[model samples]
Target chain A: MYRDPSDVNRVASLGAGPIGGGWTAHFLARGYDVNAYIHDPAERDALMAVVETGWVSLTGLGLALGASMDRLTVTSDLAEAVEGVGFIQESGPERLEIKQALYKRLGEIVPADVVIGSSTSGLTMTEIAAECETPGRCVIGHPFNPPYLLPLVEIIGGKQTDKAAVDWAAAFYEVAGKAPLVMKKEVPGFVATRLQEALWREALHMVANGEATPEDIDIALKNGPAPRMAVQGQCMAFHVACGEGGMATNLDQFGPALKWPWTRLEAPELTKELRDQMVDGCNAMAGDRHFRDMAAERDRKIVAVLKAVRDG
Target chain B: MYRDPSDVNRVASLGAGPIGGGWTAHFLARGYDVNAYIHDPAERDALMAVVETGWVSLTGLGLALGASMDRLTVTSDLAEAVEGVGFIQESGPERLEIKQALYKRLGEIVPADVVIGSSTSGLTMTEIAAECETPGRCVIGHPFNPPYLLPLVEIIGGKQTDKAAVDWAAAFYEVAGKAPLVMKKEVPGFVATRLQEALWREALHMVANGEATPEDIDIALKNGPAPRMAVQGQCMAFHVACGEGGMATNLDQFGPALKWPWTRLEAPELTKELRDQMVDGCNAMAGDRHFRDMAAERDRKIVAVLKAVRDG
Candidate 1:
């Protein structure tokens, strides 16, 4: 049903927004001929612009042997775009009905054995696969921002998804130089997003209370836990912090602090003022750079970190 | 009272345990003459072992000019460690009584202008400065593990702490290649540690409930948020996730989900079973490597990340 990444040369991107365009750029950079499908004809220009911008970023990260911008093909015909692609990555709008309808249409076109992965961030594959003709082949292939650079791809399967398909997608992503973590359980927002949400909620609470600024929070992570995080996982690092006591010592020492208000997991209300603050704060952090330029800069930094993590 | 990093030749480590030894190694790597105070005469060999181990990792990260183990001087006599040093870094112990007693003794010995920094992770500077005659000079200069590699040093001031002293310490740390985040208002765990505690608490709960393994939780971070975390803060990354919508869209979309059971900020009871699983999970992750070896590897990787972040 599936082949190695070498054999699976053509991949289909079933939406050409930022996430979808990112998938296209990543696939192209991985030397896969990317056939992108879009509902609107005007999107061809904007989507390809994203691909060209991403291409430069991927180049800084280093591309595959046969990678090129010429590998991207935009098509108005949905069936034609996915025709014989070994893999289908869908990044449609977040609406359930929209995704279900797209999956139903894609199922009718793509080969039944070819794996179809949804880049849906929070939606579960179980719900998304409900309308697919061959539910067993559908799974979540969630990638972090600027997919060509950040290596993590969460491989999650729905109740109907075949474990084999999940394994195949996981293996394929690895060959494409992505770190894929398979979730045994289907948790909303997945693990990373869940962890991220906790910290994010806490940050918002701080901003609302004026305890800290957004720039301060960003600087805290970029210069602090992240440098350590690039090397070892947070829990593993906590294990090291336990000294002779291991996690047991850390748990004993810091466990009580959890009951304290260290983190406000419950989000602050997004009042008009708070909303304005958050937006203004982020804009200030971005400063003069355009989003694409900031993204390219992010991709460059991520590449360096990835290289260090791999080589070290 | 403080001089440029080049002019400030000597710094003192009031304790020669893991944290103190780390400070010693880091100070030495920054080309400071490090005088380390230990409780027992027999502790010198073990303390030096830790410093020597840290030096190799720091050297790999690129050592400062004149950096060497030859610059480290260990003594059991407290006065010998702090008498001539420009700054004092106290990582003695967590017990408030022990730290207060030590600070009182140091206040009587060291010069009033020589700033004394406590590496106490959770304890506030005010509590630690209670017994010090010159409490204004005492500040919290908390460093993450393997301080030579990780850039963050949380600089906090006590109630009696002079604003100028805090500013001076912040400036001094920046000169030593450390990113200092000054706490405008002190909380229980401070910023990074507070954020870390929330994630850690949630991770423990997941493991306790059999929802995820320790490795699963760790892989989730290393693969998912860590790469992103290496570059941007979690909050900044969330800002990017909002697309053109920015932070307001992110909040509108996901803020309500915060009430969901994504993170259990209240930690699970540290039952024997949970503790054993945690220790065993971390041990399995470490495999045959000794703690020191694991620490060394972590140091090397952190150095790589720091280099990437700095250069990229």
Candidate 2:
């Protein structure tokens, strides 16, 4: 069952570090009572320090209805950390044995209904779920660096995971001001990491081949394609490329380039769902403008940008 | 010698298509007297419409000093268009024969001292210059789409091209309210297109695979990576990723990811120049703060964002 945000007043964060500390701070700043715990009691000072430092940034981000630093309860024992908590965020060491054991033990203590979110970078839920008796309660809540800062939280459910758990976490995250990207299926690296990996790899390739300097690479993005990305995503950008032609025109062009091996990657076959999504996104960004008119208007508005960076 | 902006008041546009029209509008809006010519006089009406339409956006972007749409003079004759002009921008078809023939003709009309810049997207300067008698006066001044708005103009010199011509074009572009991305050497797709191509290919791959819908892909970037890119480039983003360790730490972590077959594209070996550029770019972005501090600051600032997106 999808738990209501109001019902999740207290959340538990295990294995406090940079990500865990940030998550704790976020929960606290969002007016939730966060019961935070680490592997050992000796790291209490460091954990609190991370939360305090993170608090400054969170406060800057603006506090919620009852947000406060005082709402955080630091615990030494794992069971004590989970005490009376409605939700669990596991940010433990990225080790198989430790996490497998931790989840198994936590599963016995916490109620079967409570959803446990792991902040694993690469570990799949299928592997971690094996250790949990209530496997349905476990899910992946992989966050980018600085959890309190970056708004993205990629949610992926593995084999033996319940849809309810994923839904609960996604709903909870939306209420908490995070952009929860819930994947339909488990994909390696997820969407953000995979896309970033592709771009980064190409960048490295160019640099290694004496193609361009790092500064040169960065400046190009800052000035050109990235500004468009800042406003629109890659699919929409291609949609805009079609001028009045829309997605069909884009695909027509994309077809030749796909075969060219332009950037070392090959494209998957064009499915109807992907095409429809591409077209719909462009229409949304297009607003009242006709498909063709959107292109003219796009080119027009782009021609009229305010002096973002003035030259002396 | 860098020609004075005043001495270069009269500029010639050797094509009146989209790019040519955009260039004409930009020059006119920047207060330069422009002599614009296309292949046919019948296209004059169409070209002027493009400029007039582009002017609305140009005015919104804020016109340059003494900028006016009234200063544009459209001509059908090639010699008449280039007569007594300080600089000539060729916006011809991407055909080898057409560009070769046009540049050869324009080279004869304009003095050897007047720099002629080509708007060829992918054509090398070496190929285009071979057609020109005074190749020293020819250089690549490739502008991004919707040139009147976007500030980027990648300036590349050919194998036989003179540095003086490149320098003059760069100075002129800066004076024209364009970001002159002066290249150290010529590479395929230059910096902007290369990076864009890389990003675009991955987007296509994702769409083809049915792993995620197009809307999902766009939203992921718009809400996640693009914002960082809008404010800072990729190199700086990685520097911030190092937490407090800075570039050194980033490299250490990136070292493993680089080896991973995360993307279909393979990374070139990390040569010294590539490594140094990455480090230096990060250091520059880091500024006074050590790399570790940047991570703390990045998190803090991100936390402080009162809903990063305010505009509708």
Candidate 3:
């Protein structure tokens, strides 16, 4: 039987690059004694530098009780790093073969019930855990850059992984001060990354076509939509913009614009089925709040964000 | 001779919908007496409601000296609204025919030197001004929704528009407390809208495919990239993520992911020329600030925003 995520204490952080170092800092800030494994001992100084830099923002955000840098332990021996840890977070290189070999080794060293979460942003857990004897306990816990600051950690389970392990990882991330988005099904780049890449590609197209420069795009985004998006996501923002009518009103008003050659990506046709799904989805997100109330909340948050940005 | 944009005190706001009403409120908050034109008399209450609600947030953001909502005047007669006004902001229907007819009448009413800025997000200035007698004075001053709070105003000129008019409009927006992105060339949806549409389409695709729910996307975005994007934009955010190496290191590190089918939208080829342009653009945006300093500033702003969000 696996130990409940709440009962887990010490954790192993494999690899100490940017993502790995960020995870190490995050785990340490959460009051966990971290055994950080690096491939080469020469990276020790650089890894320490990341932890120190990350600690500043973590302190500002408030550190967990009993959190200290002294609790961190670094080593080059893989077996020593994984010894007696309750959980394992692997942030190895983005290579299928390397990850398979690493997982295979990790599977043999750790108990069958110990969860191993890979931090590979590109490769999926399905491929990474292919050679592991205990693939059922392996999952993906992808974090955005500067993981200690950003609250999102995308949780995905591979084809062979057990659902219980995915649940355990999600609960663990939540306990560790993260908003874990447990995906229903695996997709390329997951949620946030896909959305980001789509917008990024469009920006690149504009620059390549000479429609706008990089600086122009940045100014347009930061000044126009970025602040609002920070407060409310795209769908909710549009729903609130239509006032009391909500998503149905928004779709009717601007759905035709989606068909317009506004973006290079061809939009999925707005069939009635898709339309209903979106309307219902937004309604569910809104819960019992009226459009006016949601709009007020959005406005309040936006004001706070603008003030913060201005003061900073 | 046209009065300079700085000297313009009273302006005409044609149409009384959300965009026009928001613009009316923004202009009033900026201490301008606005002559608001509406086609129907029944829309008076709705327009007033928008202005009233917008005022609350505008007040929170701080009002300009001598600002007053009582300075606004509503009129049904088009000719009466444009009379003696120093500038005109037409947010009439998005249809090209309605706008062309409206612009033709306005061109006949106002002085040839008086600048006219349209808030049309879809139709281009070139198409709208084709029927006008003085197309040279007409320019696009497209704004995002809830224009009273958001600071962006994209300034683009039609083929027939004079360069001086675009300059005057950009200068005027600055005086009105708006960040105007003067586009080098007009493209479909311009910059911000295109970027937004690309992301929205991908989001729709995800929902239609049952890969994720609206709530999941919202949580993923708001918790992950939205806060950072609020501080530094997409390009600069990635630039800072790579630390001291800036864009060059970032492109070399994650540029391959652009081709990874991460998004439905196809990415532009990352050619040598494109890479150079992106690097130079980011370097220009960074100015003399070192990467460490920029990263520190970004963290400070993000922390402030997170605190505001949490407190709100």
Candidate 4:
């Protein structure tokens, strides 16, 4: 049964895994007809369940775009998913070969005008576009996790990605009620991940070195900039830290001290020793809680908090 | 006129100048003795007017720590400000020599254990620490702007810093109801600034190259992970991005792809032309609004948003 197609744009999530499912929820809740494709047939039910729950939450929050599961179609065929879609979000396995094959196939079947984006955190737009026939039409529309809630989508370009393609993807994401930032050029991990990795790497190093407890380190972020960062980006955050002097004043005063010996820039060789330490450290820190449960708790609180912000 | 020092633990901010005054307000409002240091001498009355306005708005929202500005002290003398004070958060000039001279004087007169912390964003802890005779004791308790609202404080280490000094400072901040994360080793820009700089550099590069408009870039952050990050750290944020795959699944799937040349690692040589483009781009994007007003608005919304989340 078809609802108003005019009200619901035809959108497809190229990989119906968890990220793909999130993409599905985001679009479907916004009244888009979602065509979700997943390689593993067994997980289809579970995936759909997640989508349903997402719809419930979105509807409760009044963010639901009046769409329902009746509009969602699950499939394994790439062509079936891509046909007549206005926007396509590919969240397949991150392997270049796998993505290349998938995109090459998608390029052949999907209409040329459709905006195709990859939920890749690592691969450059160039790498993703290399395999596509009309490389300029494909771009990276990397979103933060649980796309239904978070609004950031880093719009990056592959080597051959046309400027128009990036602009188109940004506009599409905006229309989707998503926040989209277009990168000047391709970069690993884009903006957010790279900043995060730097801090994470430092945390890992601290855990490895035994300078402070994991609890202490985590407490630092939870209690501090992580919250402020929710509102202000880093530079502005520091600019504020520097008070009226702005960044230049901050730099001239504090920049030289960074030359000390403590900051180990070289990535720790993730030897078995480092790996074991990480595994042990994280497990010990997390305790008996499953990561999924932890993630859910995180999401629930984030949603609750964001909702509070929205309402206030 | 003696205001009760007992209620003095309740702090009130007089000016919304930079978010520094807001940080001072955070401590005082949270049940600490605060004498807010407003830079403008003539605007003392005007500043108090500003503080009174915020008081009605903020306290009405129940943010005051069981007390209100009835306990606050507004003073011009740096010495009188810290007299009988448990902590002094000096967010004055960002100039190194100026701040150094101020802290040096503060070091000579203020009670030895009063825990002097500057909100210096980029200044090295070593240099700031060097101003005091008891060098190790002085530390940088850098907070993100809008500290009264957000919970991040980058506890940095300087050269000649004693281990206990960092701990003591951390403890003091924690007791003050702030989350203080101690950097294992001193890094330039600390953990947050460095990562933020990396992202900003890339953004500048994009603007210089004419890839995307500033509004589009800012929208990317505002609408996306900037909001999500309020609750979760970056590592976990990415974990969520991988959906239910958790960190392991996510790392496995996306790890290999990270090797791609997606990041503009080579620092953008900020040519004169590039710098001009960046300034112009950002200025046009920001429009005619004063940065301070812009910042105050951001903090107000942030406080509201965070409070909403807290209530939710």
Candidate 5:
């Protein structure tokens, strides 16, 4: 059953690293009580700042939220955060054991009806669900970063996951004003992450093999195909890009090029040399911004673009 | 040199198919003297009507030019269209031989100074330029369909093509209110079309292979990734989608899946079996709408979304 937005008395974020904090801010902005848990002491202030910045940005975008900033409660204890929560978002480290243990703890305490979701990139739900007593209650509620603005959530289920449980989580995300897509089965990386990884791997391989500059690869996507893709999904964009003859004609024509030597699906392992090359390429491609600052900057830009779309 | 919008006299479209007609309308709507040469007799009235309809749409969107509607001229005579033209756009069939022969004819008559461009999907400038007497002047000026609405033009050059020619075409398209991206080297399908074809081929393969239904595939993109992608380009979208860890972590953790069998690189042959599968799948997905009408309706919706972005 989907929790009514008005009925959500408390919301808990199990991991208050950058992403977890964002989730906390999202619930808080919507007037739901937030219990955010973070393990790293050094990260506490930064994560809190992230939540505040996100709240400020959302308000700046004129998004109406009836909640006050005081609704947020940050804690170091997981059980304290999970108590009386209608929804729990786990944004722990991507490691399987860490997630498994977190789910076990949360599953033991949170009400049986509460929805449990993971911010996992691509790890299997079957594996993650192994930690919970009510395994069926655990679903992959994968959200893109700065969760408040980017409206995407991949809802996937594991072998033991109940259909009702997945549906409940999906419904809750929808009520939270997030665009949620349900995956039929548990797949590694789910869908969006898988497609992205494939593209990223190829892009890196191009740099590793010296086919193109790191900057060119990014520019190739950003200034080139990216604009068209913004409006049309990759497949639909190709349907138009290849003309009305559609996928059949395009496949027939470009199918031979799939075997092109330039497209290196397999590159050398990321040894010290490869790592240096990759880092250099990425640093050159992205310029001088540090990762966190870049990520926050990206989130701000996403908000600006989303606000433009909303206003228009 | 950019074609002066105020000083523009004649605009020629060498092959006026639907895409060509869009370019034709773009020039005419910008108050230039538009001339088109189309092979099919039945296309004349329809093309003219489309141009008129496009003018109305542009005016409604507050992007209209003061050009008279009756100024659009369609003729069977290719020579007549090219005579004294300041700019030329070729949107003929994708057959390389046909394009080569047509370019030869165009080369003989069109003045040396006139900027000529081919809107060929995958055909490279090198191949098209080889047939021209003044090969150095030939360049690929590929535009996204519904050119009057989509502002992108991929300006790519062949080995022998002159840099001045590509720059001129870029400036002209910019003056005509289009964003032109220059490709350093000519590749099949250029940038947008290549990425599009790659994703499309995989999507069709997935449908053919029984992984997902057509409607679900469309839903997965439109409601989920496409909305976010509409704001950020694909690379940046991935940067955001990967959460706090960013592309490096995303690549290392999920990169192995690039070689996974999830994507069918070799699609099933387009036999009667595949045709039936596609027709049935798409028809069931689209429900009651005929394909042509559905395509037109889709275009209209895209125009609305694009106008939101452009005017917003």
Candidate 6:
């Protein structure tokens, strides 16, 4: 049987690119001994440079007990890197064939009980693990860029992935100080990327239409919605914005505006079913907190964020 | 000639709803003597309540010299509110007819040189200023909710508006502590709202499709891109993420992802013209700073913001 995630103290970081190096730095800071694998030995200096840069920010965020850069080891041999590591993170190039072949090798080398999490932002794990003999252990543990600073880690499983593997990965990432979102269904771009792409495409359209410059769009966002969003996401922010009435009042007031030609993307029809889902979801998110209290908390956090950005 | 925006110390804030009341509190905190007009006498207390709520945040952000809530004066009579004010901000109901009639009365009551800035989120300046005789001085000064905290104020002008009016509104908003984006062309939702709506609609689709819940989406955003966005907007953030190569490297690496079916919105074709526009815009935004320096600055600011949010 695979050791519990909390009992696994060593990790294998496969790939020497930005994402892999970031994972190496983060794991080391969390007091884990890391084995980092690279295809080209000449890229060793570049990977270490990435780790050195990441270490500054990690130190600022604080290090775990016994955390040290010396705990990391680099190797060019694939089998050597996977030896005795409880967890394996694969962040190779985005090409499907490259990832499939790598996963096939990883499945043969690593213990069957160990979980292998791919960090591919584009390719789904189902496709990447197609050649793997032990596909049930392969899952997606994607992170945003500069993974050392950002806390999000999206956990998704392939069609052949076992539920136990997904749960194990989630628990491991939590212990590693990550905010994990274990997806229930596979979709293109998952959640955050889809939302980000939507916003980014609209920004490009505005520039194409000569409505605003890129700088104008960025300034508007950083100064307007971004700070508040850092405190609370869009749904909860609007829920709090409506004050005591919460999201129900927000829907009544702004639902019609959703039909306006505000964006190029077409909105889903606000069906009764969809409306209830939204209201219920927001209520679940709010739990017992009153709208007034949430709004106040949001305002307080936004003030702090604004000050931080300004002072920095 | 109208008094210079820097010399405008007294302003009229018409309407008493959330937007108007937010403007009232902001102006008062900036040390401007504000005359607020409401249609209903019963709303006076409610208006003050909004101001009181805003005052807590405004004070936390630091009050300007000589700033005090006592500088605000409430009146039900529209004429009394406009009397002797140097600038006017109209935040009445969203109906075009109501706004047109209000603008007509505002044009007749205030001097032609005094710029009338509307805070409508939906209606365009051209449509709202249609019935006004002094349309040349009418402009849009739309602010996000809780204008006292968020610094962005998008300034737009109608076809009848003078260039001087747009410039004047931008200057006045800056003097009142706003990061103003003076738009070059009129669009339906302006810059920020279009971007925000695109993201929001996509989020709704995700929830509707049962891919994720509202809480899941919120957790993904708050932990992923939102905090970094608070420090820098998307364009600059991506530019810095590519390291020494800047935006050019970023485009070469990830531009293909734009063609992927990641979002429901159709992206504009990545023509050379658009590419050059984006690259040039980012280069101009970067100015004299090297990519490494900017990345360091971004990391520092993001760290501060994350710490602030976590502590709060």
| Per-residue lDDT of model 1, residues B241-268, tens digit only | 4544444455556545666766653233
Candidate 3 Cα misplacement greater than 4 A, ranges = B77-80
Cα RMSD, each candidate: 13.1, 3.8, 2.0, 14.3, 14.2, 1.7
TM-score of 5: 0.73
lDDT scores for all predictions?
0.72, 0.76, 0.89, 0.58, 0.61, 0.89
Regions of model 6 farther than 4 Å from truth:
none
Q: After superposition, how far is residue B217 of candidate 4 from its true place, in Å?
A: 3.5
Name the lDDT value of residue B273 in candidate 1: 47
lDDT of candidate 2 over A46-109, digit per residue (tens): 8988888878777766789888888888888888889888889999998888889988898799
lDDT of 4 by residue, B1-312 (tens): 222223234332223254556565566556565677665567577556545533433443346446556567776666566677655676766678977777678778766655567788758767765677766656788875444444567786677666676777777667665667887666555555444444444444444344433343344455554654454444434443444344455445554434443334432233344333323433443456554443333333343444443343
Candidate 2 vs 5: which has more lDDT: 2
Writing each residue's lDDT as its tens digit, candidate 5 over B1-312 gives 444544557788766565787788777776777888887766798677557645644454344456666777788888888877888888888898988888888888888778788888768778887778877778888886556545568887788888988888888877776667777555555555444445544444344433433333444554444444444444444433444444444444544555565443322223344333323332344456443443333323333333343343
lDDT of 3 by residue, A88-124 (tens): 9999888899999999999899999999998888788
> lDDT tens string, model 4, A1-312?
122224337898977665787788888877778899888778698788667655544554345546777888888877777887777898988899988888888778877777788998767767776778977788888887556556678887777877777888877787777777777555556665554544544544444444534444445554544544454344434444443444445445654433433344432233344333323433443457554444333333343443444343
lDDT of 2: 0.76
Instruction: Write the candidate numbers in order of decreasing TM-score.
Output: 6, 3, 2, 1, 5, 4
Kindly list the per-residue Cα lDDT of model 2 for residues B163-225, writing each as its tens digit.
888888888888877778888767767778777777666766666666666777777776677
lDDT of 1: 0.72
Flag clash pairs in model 5. A122-A189, A230-B230
Best model per DockQ: 6
Per-candidate DockQ values are 0.21, 0.49, 0.78, 0.13, 0.07, 0.82
> How do all models score by TM-score?
0.81, 0.87, 0.95, 0.67, 0.73, 0.96
CA displacement after TM-score superposition, residue B81 of candidate 3 (Å): 3.2
User: Which of candidates 1 and 6 is the stronger one according to TM-score?
Assistant: 6
- Worst lDDT window (10 residues) for model 1 chain B? B274-283
Interface RMSD of 4: 12.8
After superposition of all CA atoms, the RMSD between model 5 and the true structure is: 14.2
